[model samples]
Target: MEKIKTLNFAGYFRNFAPILLLFFITSTGFAFQDDRDFNEYSGEILNNKNGKAISSAYLSLNNSNISTVSNTDGEFSLKVPKDLMDATVTVSVLGFQSKTLPLDFFKVEGTEVRLIENVEELSEVTLYKATNARLLVQDMLAKKDENYLSDESIMTSFYRETIKKGWTNVSLSEAVVKIAKSPYNSSKKDLVSLYKARKSTDYDKLDTIALKLKGGPFNTLFLDMMKYTEYVLRDEMLDSYNFSFDQPTKINDRYMYVVDFKEIDESDPWYYGKLFIDAETSTLVKADYSLNVDDKKKAEMMFVKKKPSGSKVYPTELNYQVDYAQNGDKWHYAYGRAQMEYVVNWKKKIFNSKYKIDSEMVVTNWEKYAGDNWRSENTLIRPNIVMVDDVSGFNDADFWGSSNIIEPEKSIQNAIDKIKRKLD
Candidate 1:
């Protein structure tokens, strides 16, 4: 009897300890499970009138932190707490009236939000040239940030133009470049000759020239000149010109402020034109200006340079135009056009190079890769072509240089490396 009683006491104690531990763990797990359960929904926006997909529309929850934009295909997915079953959702787009609906409007699984068209109020404001337009332009230019001058600055862009004369076309291109600090102290190389039919092919003669440009005088001089020109334009043209503001206009559902500028001094190299800026982002949307090329001295010097037999001089009465579109939270160039007419004098022969060059560049695609703020890997889709016509000259050979003279691979690689340094 005594042995039996003692065995029962130990057995009961051991059984109770395990049971208590198990209960504690089960309770803790249940608590965590409750916190982890969240409800999510996928949805789309549609034009109520047409029943078509609506893209770039903003969607947000009334009480929660969830918010997102519709994709190009007009589709979206969002997650929220299950307890938000009674919350409200709001959707909005520019030029369209906003809509708000209770969560109960859609079944918990997926929802379709309908947006109605909104009538915008029109303003009637007459725009005339302001007396202080020149002064206003100067002030704006002076206030331009110094970051614009840096090679690594995000605002840098590539520009190429094809001048079409009477019948033949040629390429005369320049890029808004930024100069980066380099490891090697090399000189600048000569222009690598490229083939007309296969522009990607580089000429061999430019090999020594390209290598010598590692830290060369030509590159240094070129960069210095570009920076100086930009600085001068911003300080003298933008800061000194007067402007007249016009009524706001709508572009891609964004409000924009339009301003016209005129030069204070006709002799100034400043362009006279109109500028459009996004009211919300304060970013430039468009700029259309006419430049004066009346400086006989500058024009003569530029014309005297023997532009390869086929190449023509830069245009006079140049019209510079730029258009922009939004990319995520940033603004980027959508399209650009530069038209000018120049007189080329080669071998004492007066050749009227009346040229119109246009370039249509678009961001066909983009992707994010690994890197830091100092550097990044980006691929660009550029569809570019150059058309040049010799309005005055009849010789087609004058425009055709020896093809395959420069190594295309080396020239392109060098150009890319130079761009990377500036970006850094």
Candidate 2:
């Protein structure tokens, strides 16, 4: 028999391994796990004072590499091994006190834990009279090496892309990926590989004329303005944007300077957004921006990869957000999200189709050492694959084995369950 070649969701290509489908079920503030292994626990993180949901809190077992983060609804699931049953798990967030609990604290249906807020006195504001906005941006760029990661590292990340037609979600694609993060001073691009991936089965509902997203992870990484300075913030481009100082905010107990940037020249397509700089360190900690798609024809050229001939498409919105978190003395890329909406007009223009596309990535775990460079053939890149059209079905409940991933929303879980019943 001729040999068959197949690649598993874990990024390994082996001969004769069973080809199985991976599916993620997201529901309303609920996490589902296999009862066969009761070690896997589910719970919610909340505020101790007001009992509000504490989104984006980090949780992990002490002395162990296994971990996961709470979703926007303050829910998470962590699988504990028999040996680690006695270990305490810690929950922490940027502006909250850390809370620890025993593994036995969680029940099958799940339990809730609250963390106290960490309030501190604000630092005295120092008004500088130098170049102002220009000088602040310059310092942010100059201190890249001193503030960001100095060495290459391996990061395990969760990636998700959703396509919506009007208000109904037609397609959802998600993956657990391993990324090779290059050093701040290096010119090499960050590398990503699929560790585990799955696609929603309701993809058939999508418009027959496909709405595709290109360069998955690569597209988001490029939005790291600090790393790709020339793309948006070159010295020459500085003149095109009107920069002003905004209110100072707090992040991780440290004060941050908010810089507002808007394109003064509307003659050309430009970007407008806010940059949050660490007040003491002058590092670009977070950026929330969007491309101005004023020129309909020009914006169409930026997003339309391939479409049916008679279909006329107009770009409506293009937005991007990237955030970094401090780890010890250095800060690393923590999470990134991009959202865009476009309207497609048919030949007559009377009937039009509107599409919303979104992508989110979160770095769950990282190590300073990856040993060796990832093989060229194993890299995930553009033009070769489109993540949404590639994945299908579910084979097991343990979709992500030992790796950390963002918990799915409750709506997604309920959708998965309903779909599974129909398929069966």
Candidate 3:
């Protein structure tokens, strides 16, 4: 068996982009020191008509900022403290009718919450008023200061990443970090400090190669396109893209304009995705984009930082999705996800290995920064960070567990179980 080595995240993009750190180590401590007396409410969010699992559904506690997103399995867990048990939790998604229920309605055994698709169409007048999708997006990007939070605040977020070799899970890493979120209108980057993190990797499953995701939660934070315009729609790069309108829709009763965008300049065919814009406020509420990796050479440059001398590695697909939450007229980064898939070929070996890496971060709770009350015992303020459990000497106390997280998909849970078997 090959031992996993500690690595640093190295990202300097000729095209701009990056997730997945091949990790192996079983660190199962609940690292949820979000300063809340949390009582995790667990459930599965589903589609009412098809009864299919609804991934990426947003759940929030009523009259408060606490919220979370459903996992790929449509499973959800919300950590509500004892004082908030009387409050209601609302479940909402892009195309679904939001459902709200009192805390008493949910059962610890796992409640099922379903939402119907919101098929309401846009009036001709609404479409006519916004004929130019590019212009509409431009207007929305311009109003960033007014649409997003303008003051500095502190946020407690949960982050998890998994690595798989072929069909078997090999590595898992998860963390809960404190963010000194900067004002939306400014260019200052957010500062992060690792509050708690854990990882478990199945080394026996790996034949030789190990993958590492650089930057961890810091990279995911930059996915907030509204706050980090240069990361996606820099003024010069905007002209290179073609923007068109898709079917208009409603999210949380707000009139929304669905705009589809793709790179028109093939020389740098970088991304293509959809934007969910709030029609009235011209705010970008959600964005889904992926790097156009048809040119294998370009994909390699963007992701494959390093590998063994004789081994070949190239990214097959890279997809990202960022979601925002509206509290009154202001918005904040709600959730972000990055999925990366690659094919690895060993020089002397006939059989090749396929690897898939996924990482996601969610803002569970936040408050306006009272600068005096803030301090990080183990801070990670740099732009590039690696969370190695053994190297960092992770302590079990206050570490996060499966709660306040996107419930793992069946495959990931199986991987965790397999590793746990060895530990037990």
lDDT of 1 by residue, 1-424 (tens): 1111000000000011211100000011101114234455566788999988886565556654344455445665544457777888777654466788886675544578888775454243233223353443443333333212112212222223333344333332232211121111123211211112211111132211110001111111222211223422445435466678755565555665677876677553445677765555455556666656577455434322223443334435555555544444544333344444554334544555353433322211122212343222222111111212112211232221211011112233344344335345
**lDDT, each prediction:** 0.39, 0.67, 0.75
Candidate 2 global TM-score: 0.78
Backbone clash tally (model 3): 14
Query: Which regions of candidate 1 deviate over 4 angstroms?
Result: 1-160, 170-197, 200-237, 302-314, 345-353, 372-424
Query: Which residue pairs come into collision in candidate 2?
Result: 21-395, 26-412, 26-413, 27-409, 27-410, 27-411, 27-413, 28-410
TM-score of 1: 0.40
Candidate order by decreasing TM-score: 3, 2, 1
Candidate 3 stretches greater than 4 Å from native: 1-37, 123-128, 372-378, 390-403
Find the 10 residues in a row with the least total lDDT in model 1: 5-14
lDDT by residue (78-132, candidate 3, tens digit) is 7777777789988888888888899988877588998999866565535436889
Candidate 2 residues 86-108, lDDT tens each? 89987766567677888778775
Instruction: Look at candidate 1 and tell me the lDDT of residue 305.
Output: 26
Q: Give model 3's TM-score versus the native structure.
A: 0.89
